[model samples]
Target: MVLPRSSSLKAFLVGAGLCGALLAQSAAQAAESSVWQDVQKAGVLRCGAAVAAPYVMRDAKTGDYSGYFVDLCRDFGEKVLKVKVSFVDTNWDNLVAGLQSNKWDLAMALNQTPERALAVAFTVPATDYQVSLLVNKDNPKLAEVKDDISALDKPDLTFAVMSGTAQDKAISSVIHSGKIMRLPGMDEARLAVMSKRADVLVDASDTNHLFALANPGWTREILPKPALAKQGVSFGVRRDISPADLEVLNIYLRQKRDTGDIQQLVDKASIEANAAK
Candidate 1:
């Protein structure tokens, strides 16, 4: 027993509408894939980052940039994407600004939280680290690891951090001592501890460890109290970037993580630098 002509017509219309919707979705995806192609045509992949030692720091004498962030991104460019990456030597305050203006194609070091996700799209988690406490070696006052950044609340304590960053915000609101000392950049923040200009520095755990090795007389501690927060490290791309390219990069990043290649790079870097003295 078959349906009447009117009923059959309605069913055909419904099936046709579903096919149209599927076709439209496929076309949209095709358009989105154009992003990576555009980058390839441009010839240079501009990456922006600050001079945060062990992250993306510069050499003092040669004025050349170096650090884990630099190493990681450069390899991602040459090895993964097979592109030529050029550095823009950006600052934290200007990272979002630069990306918005299209001055740079990507933000090299980014913390991918929901707030940041709104501003720009992020790649898969390249790494993760926690906020840690750094102090002079002789400063027994800070021996205990602080789970909360608020430990800086003691009127006698002060924090040194980059001039423009989330650390400054954390120090003002949570630490709340009104004693947050400002350094020009990450390099200076590391020095603030050694020169006795600042009591402590709060930054990413791995970076702080790099500083501890370099300074020798300084101690790096991830507070025992509680993680004030853990941030997923990732690369940032502007909202205007093509979704297709971003998807490809995302897949590329995930593959890199799954292969244990990421850890292998870290392990090799650790051995080569031997900075954790």
Candidate 2:
């Protein structure tokens, strides 16, 4: 039997609403996957960058940016995406937030941490990261410490670390007795050690290695036996990025890694950073 006129009209309206909602959801998904299309349309891929020496660096006078991650960003944008690459300066604390707010398309040189994984997506890592300590060559207090970082956990020794960095978190969790001098950037943290305001400078192993190379007689680096916060350093993108878009980045990284181009970039950046010191 056919339904009454009133019932048929109500059913039609409900079905129409459901269909409209489904269409809207599909459109949203399409828009999310269209990030590549959007970049192509704009003709530029903006990368959010924070200076971290070999990973990311900025020129003092010219404000030009360079580093392994910077090179990767340029290569991906220009070679793979066929777009111009632009760097948007940011700091460690804002890298995730900038990506969330659409301030940049990619956040460069971010360590893939579980805390950050909650808010963003990461592409394949360009490099691995581990923490190390930089200390004065004549610091007798650390003479017996050897490879154990825990020996530096003393009230008299102050550790300088870049605020909101992975190194800061790693050291803070274990060194309760030592005073922590949290500074805003790498330069400030290095200065704290140089001026004797802090006894140890905690930073990336690669960075500390370069620093020791630059200041041969003054500083040295200690790589702990049990590495601290060892993780992959990757590019951060919006969590909603489509698998297709994400794959494009992963493929590019794999190609560079297989071709040994990533290592070359690392060496070049390390030399530049050491010479600039």
Candidate 3:
């Protein structure tokens, strides 16, 4: 029905006010949403994770992202959260910086440590791994790893480590060895050792396990003692974010774990051993 000009003016003004208020609320929500929420809304979760074996990797045939950690991020962010997963090829050196600058909202996979806590808060340690020892398949002498990884420091023992990785941090404490080579990521570390350029490559236990399964021809041996270090996996979030924001994300993570969606992904990615079990 037609209204008086004065009434129409009032109605238009009221509608405009409501719209303004709604827009403001939306803006506030966008600001508050953890990277995960932003990902959900964007219809894609931009994740930063090492593009190496059994964590987050590209399939040689299909060129799709696939791995234990990769599957977790994709399934949760894509299937459960209903957001497509887009991964940023990353290594240890720049992943933290990427997050700080808002390059991506989260890391699909990472280990939690006290020092790292200063930069990012994890989502309650979803998985576990050991600092393992890898050696040449043909040579059996390097199979045994002593306690505390002391052998890594021997001048004759060439060891390769993923650059800027937690392994490098741990190794830094005692790397007086021949040549401590730095690789782009764990994958290259394995390659270095495989080609015999380096005597050893220390990576996560589960990562090693998965790597062996994926590449059946490569024979490897675990330290038999794991050498002792506490490393667990969790999702990464910005450090400066609100505690309330973290708690909210924790809620989603807990829900995902309880439903066994997490485990299912682990199995699918062929890294069930990496899961908490």
Model 3: how far residue 140 lies from native, Å:
7.0
Which regions of candidate 2 are displaced past 4 Å?
2-31
Instruction: Name the candidate, 2 or 3, with the larger TM-score value.
Output: 2
What is model 1's C-alpha RMSD? 4.4
**How many angstroms is residue 160 displaced in model 1 relative to the true structure, after the best TM-score fit?**
0.3
lDDT of 2 by residue, 1-277 (tens): 9766998989999999999999999988766656788899999999999999999999989999999999999999998889999999889989889999999999999898998999999998889999999899798887777778777889989999999998988999889998999999999999999999898999999999998888889887898868889999999999988898999899999899899999999999998998798
Instruction: Looking at model 2, report the run of 10 residues with the lowest lDDT sum.
Output: 29-38
lDDT of 3: 0.70
lDDT of 1 by residue, 1-277 (tens): 8766998999999999999999999998776645556657887678897765455666557767666667777876777667898888778889978988888787876877676778898888777856777776577766663555555577777788887675665455577653788877876786776677778887877767666666564475555355645777788998867766777778877887899877776555544444422
Off by over 4 Å in 3: 1-43, 60-62, 79-82, 137-148, 213-218, 224-228, 258-260, 271-277
Task: Compute each candidate's TM-score over C-alphas.
Answer: 0.80, 0.90, 0.73
- The TM-score of predicted model 3 comes to 0.73
| lDDT of the structure predicted as candidate 2 | 0.91
Candidate 3 lDDT tens digits, 160-272: 88988777776665676556888877767878887888887777666667666655576565553435455777878888666776776577677877898667766665653
The candidates, ranked best first by TM-score, are 2, 1, 3
Instruction: Give the best candidate by TM-score.
Output: 2
Pairs of residues at least 3 apart in sequence or in different chains that clash in candidate 2: none
